[model samples]
Target: MVGFEMNDRRKIGIGLTGFGVLFTFLGIIFFFDKGLLAMGNILFVAGVMLTIGMKSTVSFFLKPRNYKGSILFGAGFCLVIFGWAVVGMIIEAYGFILLFSGFWPTVVVFLYRVPVLGRLLQQPFLMSFFDRFTRTERRVPV
Candidate 1:
């Protein structure tokens, strides 16, 4: 029965994260505007901090195992701020994939719990594709 509880702070965190994503998408769609991209990056990082707590966020970025991703992500943020939006985005995308590789399974599981989309994701082809991401041996630590 253990799961995420919908507390006020978490709710606010989710909202911030959603807004961050929306802004980032809009920024990208607008041909990589530096200001928008910088704002989006700020919001996204803030949202993640709020969502996971300041201590956890710091630890996540500071973890020795995450050095490459953290460095790349930070560099990318700097690049965006310095007006290299396209290159920054490319690096950030790579960093993001590396940093969040562990979360893919949880995302897949969450997707499977949705109503209509759950059914679609349960199909053979989709399941096969998703199963690779949701491996039994690679579970995220609770």
Candidate 2:
């Protein structure tokens, strides 16, 4: 409903569960077929993405970044490595895109701090909202 779409956790959970089922189905399509190893690899990669997407529940409930959280993160990373290796054997470009998608957000904060080529970009006086994210603040409802 409206609430699920409004919240990121629900969005990701639904997306993950939906995609997980899809990939499982896709994996089944080539069940027991040695020739379809490529499809199986794709399924494995999709499963990991799905798993990561659904991890918000644990992270939110237990306070992520704790010891157990570190272990969970390691597991996720290992899944990424295993899945990526499988995916790379099938479609290298798609694998890279998926890998980058998994990691792209980590750079968001620092991304806004990168210096531009032109001297004009260095001046904050004429900076736009997107270019000057340093002063940005949110007023979330409690």
Candidate 3:
């Protein structure tokens, strides 16, 4: 009964974050022990993104209106993981594009809320670009 009180999303987030940490650790070990630098780096990056996606997804679940970012984050991590098996470079590139597209805006927003850093982020050009890129409304105005 007590365990059941926790929602599914929380469970999922914990699971994903746990696996991501494990994979990241393994990636580091692989790099150090076997010198599989490229593979290790890929695994590490994917794990970090997976953990981030889990956080985003849990956040989205708490506030359903803002679900798109979580979806994109999860999908991006999946794509990056799958890219390891398929076309390698190209798929990874696309995955990274999707990942950044989904993740950067949230980061910008968070940074903008900070005290001192917010001032720096208030610069016109950067804010304009951040607004345009992160806006969920329209990529190209009609």
Model 1 scores a C-alpha lDDT of 0.87
User: Taking the tens digit of each residue's C-alpha lDDT, what string does model 1 give over 55-128?
Assistant: 98999999998999999999998999899999999999899888888889889988988999999999999999
TM-score per candidate, chains pooled: 0.87, 0.23, 0.38
> What clash count goes with each model?
0, 0, 0
Per-residue lDDT tens digits for candidate 3, residues 26-139, read: 644654222232344344444444544556535543455434444544454454355442233334446445444656766777787799998997899878977865686434
Candidate 2 accuracy as lDDT:
0.42
Task: Please state the error at residue 51 of candidate 1 in Å.
Answer: 1.4
Please report the TM-score between candidate 2 and the true structure.
Answer: 0.23
Q: What is the C-alpha lDDT of each candidate?
A: 0.87, 0.42, 0.52
Q: What is the alpha-carbon RMSD of candidate 3 to the true structure?
A: 9.7
Query: How does residue 79 of candidate 1 score in lDDT?
Result: 94
Worst 10 residues of 2 by lDDT: 133-142
Clash pairs for candidate 3? none
Error of 1 at 142 (Å): 15
Ranking by TM-score, best first?
1, 3, 2
Best by TM-score: 1
